[model samples]
Target chain A: MVDYFNEDITSLHDKLVRKEISVRQLVEATYDYIDKTEGKVNAFITLNKEAALKQADALDEKGVDPDNLLSGIPLGIKDNIVTKGLKTTAASHILDNFMPVYNATVMDKLDALDTITVGKTNMDEFAMGGSTETSYFGKTHNPWNLDKVPGGSSGGSAAAVAAGEVIAALGTDTGGSIRQPAAFNGIFGIKPTYGRVSRWGLMAFGSSLDQIGVMSRTIKDSALVLNAISGHDEHDGTSAAADVPDFTAALNQDIKGLKIAVPKEYMDEGVDDDVVSAIKAAIATFEKLGATVEEVTLPYTKYAVPAYYIIASSEASSNLQRYDGIRYGFRAKDVNSLKSVYVRSRSEGFGDEVKRRIMLGSFSLSAGYYDAYFKKAAQVRTLVKRDFDQLFEKYDLVLGPTAPTSAFGLGEKITDPVTMYLNDILTIPANLAGIPAASVPAGFSKDGLPIGVQLMAKALDEATIFKAADAFERHTDFHNQVPAFKGGQN
Target chain B: MISKEQVTHVADLARLEFDEAQLNNFTTQLDKIVDFVDQLNEVDTTGIEPTTHVTSAVNVFRDDVPQKGEGRAALLKNVPEERDGLIRVPAIIDKEED
Candidate 1:
C-alpha cells in the first residue's frame, strides 16, 4: 500500500515512472486508507473510487510520463467544482444530487495531466460558512482534535489531506476558506490572485471574491498543482491573460534583503495570544534568514470584514438565482404556481446560514438601501484594496496570522454568526484586494491545534509567495507532524 | 437595527420563505450582523471610486465563432422533470385569476 503520510506528489510520480508502483495500486491504497479513516473525519461528500480505479488502469496501460510530476497522483476535489457524472454538491441540499454535464476547467486541466480524482470533499453549503457545521451533510471534525472544527468552506478538503486520505486537495477560498482550513489542519494552502484560476464551473458564491486554490502537505506539491491550473481560459473572462510561470522554479530561492510588512491591525487585540506568538516567531525566522520585517499600518483593515460580507453576499444573491427548480436541482413538491415553486424550493433546499446571507444580500441591494449598504461597502472595498496597494509599495509581501485563532470547538461559534464572521478578519483583505496569499504551517498552539502564518503578495505574484513559503517550510518541522486521531471504527 | 419585517421582506425578495421561529431567530442574528457592518460607515469614502472588479480587465471578448453546446439529452439529465427535450415547469400565468 502507498503511504500518503510519507509520500508527496513528486515522490509518487518518481515511483510511478520507475515502475516501482502502479497507478491502480496507488488508487486502491488511497481508497483503503479513506475507508479506514473517513468515519471520524467525515471529509467527503462523494467518493469516485470505481471511476478512479478505471482511470488508474488506463494510466497504467498508457504508462507513466516521466516529466509529469502530477501523473497518477490522487487528489480530493472540493465538492463545488463541477465534475461530469460525479455528484458535485457544495454541501447544500439544493444540489444534493447534481451531476454536471461537463467538467470544470480545472478538472479538465488535471485530467489532461492524468491526475486521479479520488472524490469530492465536503464544504459549507454554497461556501457560505466559516465553520463546516452549516453543511447539509453535517460538520467535518478536525483531525487534530475531533471535537474542534476543521474550518470551512474547504474544511473537508483540509481534513482529508491532513488525515493522509489524499496527498493534496483542491479548495476554493472566498473569505479565507482554503487558507484557514489549511492552518487548522496543519497543512499548506494557497489562494491565487482573483483571476489566476478559472471559475467557469465552480459553483458561484461571491463572483468577485471566490478563487480556486490548492492544499497539500508540502508547498512544492501545491506549486506543482498550481502550475497546471494557472492560466487564462476563454470560458472565464475574468481570468487574466498574463503569462503563467513555472511556480516550482521558485522553491528554495533566497530571501535575503526581502522586505516584509506586518500590518499592525492584524496583530491587534482581536487575535488570540497563541496565534500571535506563532506568527511573531515566524517573522523572527524570516529576519534570521536575512529578510527585513517591519510593522506597517494598514488602517483600513478594520473595515475589511464588513465590506467583504456585503460584496460577497450581494454577488451570491445574484449568482444563486439560477437554481429556480425549473431546470435542475431540488424542487419543492406540491407547489402549483411558478412563484411558489421558486420560493418553496429555495426555502426548503437551503440551510439557515445560506438563507441568512441571501436575506442580507437582498436587503442590501434593495431600492431604498442600495447606497447606504451595497454602494458604501463597495467604496470601502476601494480603501481596503488601497491598503494592500500601499503596503506592496514598500514590502514585497505582507505576513500575518491566517486566522485570529486556531480551530474552535465544532458548535462553539456556529450559533453566533457575527462571531464566526469576525474570525476571517485577517484573510479577508487579501480577497478584497485580489492578491495572492498562502498559509503555511507555522507552529502549533498550546492546545496542540495547528497554527498557520499567512503570506500575501501583490496581485499575480504567486511566485514570491511560493518562494517565501517554501523557504519557511524547509526551515520548519511543523508540516511533518501528522494528526494522531484514528477512526472510531479503527 | 434590522426588524423582523425587514428580514421577511428581504427573504421574499430572495425567493425564500421562513417560519415564524426562524424569522425571529434570523432577525436577531441579522440585526447583530447589520450593526457590525454598520461600522463601515465610520470610514470616509467620499472621494473614493467604488471598485467593481479587482482586475482592470474589462470588455473581454472572443471570436464570434459558434461552438458545440451540450446536447439536449446531456443538458436534460439533471432536470427534475422534462418533456419533449425541454425542462418542465409549473405554469407561470394563473388561469383562475385571469
Candidate 2:
C-alpha cells in the first residue's frame, strides 16, 4: 500500500506521472483517509465522493497529463467558493443547501487542470470570525491539539491539509482569514494581492480585500497551485491585467542581498513571548541565508484592527444584503409580508457573529455616521498602505508573526469578540495594503502549538514572497512535522 | 457607548429583525467595537484621500454583446418559492393610497 498520507504535492505528482500509483487508488486512499480522520478533525462541511470517484475513473482510463498541474491530486475548497453542482454553505445555515449552478472562476481554472474536489471545508459563518468556532457546522479543531481551534474563516482548509485530508486546498482571505489559520495549523498559505486572483464566484465577505489563495504543505506546492489558479479573468472586474509568472521557477532562488523589513511594532503588546521568539528565530535564519533583516516601524500599526473591522464590516454589511429571502437560500416559513421575509429570514438564518458584523457595518455606513466611521477607517487604511509602500521601495519583503499568538484553546476567546478580532491585528495590514503575503511555519511553541512567520511583498510580487519563503522553509523542519493526531492513527 | 435606539435604527437599516435580548447584546458589543475604532478620529488625515481599494483597479468594461450566465432555471433552483421560472414574492403594496 502506498502511504499517500506522507507525500506532499510535488512527490505525489511525480508518483502519478511515473504511473507508480493509479488515480483510482489515490482517490480511494483519500476517501478512506478522510473517513478515518474526519471524526476528530471535522474539516469538511460536505464531501464530493460521487463526483470525485467519477473523475478519478476517467483519469485512470485517460492516463495522467503532465500539463494538467492538478492531474489526479484531490483538493479541498473553503465552502464560500461556488462549485457548480456542489453545495456551498459558507458554513452558514442560510446557505445550508445552496448548490451553485456555476463554478467560481478559480473553480473553473482548477477543473480545467483536472483536480478532483474532495469536499467543501467548514468556516466561520459568512467568513465573519477568526476562530472556526463561529461556524454553524461546529468548530474544526486544530490537528495539533483537539482542544485548540483551527483559526478561521479558512480554518477547515488549513486543518484539512495539515491532517492530510487533501493534497492542497483553496482559501479566501478577507482580513487574515487564510494566513492566520495557516499560522495556527503550521502549514503554508498565501493571500495573493487583491487583484491577483478573480473573486468572480467567491461569496464576498469584504469585496475589496478578498482574494482566493492556496493552502498546502510546502512552499513548492503552494507555488504550483498559485501557478494553476492565478491570472486575469474577465468575470472579475478587479482581476489584475498583469502577466502571470511560472511561480515554480521561484523555488531554490538565491536570497543573497535580499532586503527584509521586520516590523518592530508587530512584536509588541498582544503578541505572545513565544510567538515573538519564533519570529525572531526566523529573522536569524534569514540573516544566515544572506538576507538583511532590520527592525522598521509601521507606526500606524495600532490602528489596523479598528480600521480593518470598520472597513471590512462596512463592506460586508453592504455585500451580504443580497441574501434576502426572495432570491435563494433560507426563507422564513410564516412571513406574509416582504419586509418580514427579509428581516425574519435574515434574523433566523444568520449566525450571531454574522449578525453582529452586519449590524456594526450597517450602523457605520448609515446616514449620519458614514463620515465618522467608514470614511475615517478608509483614511486610516491609506496610512497603513503608505507604511508598507514606503518600506517596499527600500525592502524586498516585510516579516512578522502571522498572528499575535499560536492557536488558543477553542473555548478561550469565543466569549470576547474584541480579543478574537485582535488575533488578526498583525495580518490585517497586508489585506489593507493589498500586498501579497505568505505564512511559513516558523517553529513550535513550548505548548506544541505551531507558529508561523509572515512574508509580505509589494503588490503582484508573489515571486519574491515565494523566494523568501522557500529559503526559510529549506532550513526549517517545522513544515515536515505531522500532528500526532494523524501519526498515531496511521 | 452606543444606545439601544441607535442599535435598533441600525438593525432596521440592516433589515435584520432582532428581539429585546439581541438588541441589548448587539448594543453592548457594538458599543465596545465602535469605541475601539473611534481611535481613528485622533489620526490627522491632513491632505490624505480615503482608500476604498488598494489596487486602484479602474472600471473594466466589456462590449455591449451579451454573454452566457447562470440560466433562469439554475438561478431559480434554490428559491424557496418560485412560479413558472420566476421568483414568487409577496405583493409590493398591501393597500393603495388612492
Candidate 3:
C-alpha cells in the first residue's frame, strides 16, 4: 500500500505521472488508512468508498494527466458542501439523509481537475459550536490526543487530513471553524477572504461570514486546491470577480521587510500562557526571517465576540428558516396543522445548539430589540473592520494565536455556552473584517498539544497570507510532527 | 435580564417548541449569553454606519436568462411526504361544518 503519511499531493502526483502507482492503488491505500484510523478519530460522516473506487478505475483507464496535480488525488470534503447523489448532512439531524441533486461550485471545480472525493467529513450541527461535540453524529476526537476535542466545526476535516486519511480536505470557516481545528490537528488551514470562493450549494450558517477553504498537511497542497476552487461563479453573487492567482507560486517566496502586526488584545488575559509563548516565539522567527513584527492594538477586540455572535446567529436564524417540513428535510409525524408541522418538525429535528442560536437570533431581530442587539452589533462590526482597515494601512499582515488554547478535553467547555463562544475570540475579528486568515503549526504545549499561529492579510490578499505561511512553514518543523493516535486514551 | 417568557416568545417566532425543562434551561442560558453580549454597549457608535456586508460589490446582476432546475423527481427525492410529484403538507385552511 502507498504510504499516505509521507506522500503529499505533489509526491503522489509524481508517482501517478510515472505510472508507478495507479489511481486505484492510491484510492485503495487511502481507504486502508481510513479503515485503520477512522474508529479512533470519527472524522467522517459518510465514506464514498464505492463511488471513489469506481472513479479511480475510470481515471486509471484514461491515464493520469501529468499537468493536473490534483488528478487521481483522494480528498475529503466537508459535509456541508452539497455533492450530488452523496449524503451531505452538515452533521445535523435535520439534514441527516439529505442528498443533493446538484453539486456545489467547488465540487464541480474539483471534478474538472479529476480529484477523487473520499467522503463527506463530520462537523458541528449547522456549524454552530466551537467543537465538533455538537454534531448529532457524535464528536470527532483530536488526532493529536483522542481524549481531547478536535477544534471545530471543521474538526473532522482537520482530523481526516492530520490522520493522513486523505491527501487534503475542504472546510468552511464562518468564525474560525477551519483555522481552529487546523491548529488543534496541527495542519495547514486557510479561510480565504469572503467572496474569494463561491458559496453556492454550501449549507448556509452565517451567510456573510461563510467562506469555503482548503485544509491539508502542507501549505503547498492547500495552495493547489485553493487555486482550483477560487474565482468568479455566477451562481453565487458573493463570489469575487477578481482573478485567482496561482497560490502555489506564492510558496517559498521571500518575505524581507514584510510588516506583521501582533495585536495586544490577542495575547492579553484569557489566552493560555503556553499558547501566548508559542505565538511570541513564532513572531521572533518571523523577525529573524527579515520580517518586521510589532505590537498593535485593536481597541474594539472585546466587542468582536458579542457582535459576531449576534450577527451570525441573526443570519443563521434567517437562513435556517428554509428547513420547514413542508418542502424537504426531516418532517414531524402525526401533524394535523401546517403550523404544528413546522414547529414539531423543527423542534424534533434540531439539536440544542442550533435551537439556542435560532432563539438568540429571533430575539435579537424581533420587535423592540433590533436596535439594541442586531443593529448595534452591525455598527460594532464597522468598528472591528475599521481596526483592521487602519492596521492594513501600515502592516501587511496581523499575527496572533489561531485559538486561545489548544484542544481542550472533550466536554470541557461544552456545557458552558459562554466559555465555548469565547474560544473564537482571537479569530473572529478577521471574519468581521472579511479578510483572509490562516493557521499554520507553530509549536507544541507542555502537554504535547499543537499550537498554531494565525496570519491575517487585507481583503483579497490571500497571496500574501500564503507567502508568509509558506515562509514560516519552511523555517519550522512543527508541521512535520504527526499525531500518535492513541485511541481516545491519554 | 432575559426571562423564560421572553425565551418562549422568541421560540414561538422561530417556529420552535421546547419542553418545560428545555425552556427553563434555555432561559437561564440565554440570560447569561445576553449578559455577555451586553458588552457591546460599551462601544459607542455615535454616527457609525452599519456594515451589512464587507464586500464593495452591490446589486450584482446576471443576464436575464432562463435555466433548467433540478427535475421535479430529483427535487422531491428528499421531501418527507409527496403525492403525484407534489410535496404534501398539513392543511392550511379550515372548512366550515355543513
DockQ of each: 0.84, 0.75, 0.72
A234-315, model 2: which lDDT tens digit per residue? 8889999999998988889899999999889989987899999999899999999999999999999999989999999999
On a 0 to 100 scale, what is the lDDT of residue A257 in model 1?
Answer: 93
How does each model score on lDDT? 0.92, 0.90, 0.93
Model 3, A285-353: lDDT tens digits are: 999999999999999998999999999999999999998987778888998888888899999999999
**Residues A278-300, model 1: lDDT tens digits:** 99999999999889999999998
Name the regions of candidate 1 deviating beyond 4 angstroms.
A486-490, B95-98
Overall local distance difference test of candidate 1: 0.92
Model 3 chain B weakest 10-residue run by lDDT: B89-98
- List, residue by residue over B1-98, the lDDT tens digit for candidate 2: 79999898888889897789878888898899888888888899877899998766677898899788777888889998998888888876766311
Ranking, TM-score, top scorer first: 3, 1, 2
User: How does residue B65 of candidate 3 score in lDDT?
Assistant: 90
- Ten residues in sequence with the least summed lDDT for candidate 3 chain A: A481-490
Cα error of candidate 1 at position A126, Å: 0.6
The residue-level lDDT of candidate 1 at A177 comes to 96
What would the TM-scores of all predictions be? Answer: 0.98, 0.98, 0.99
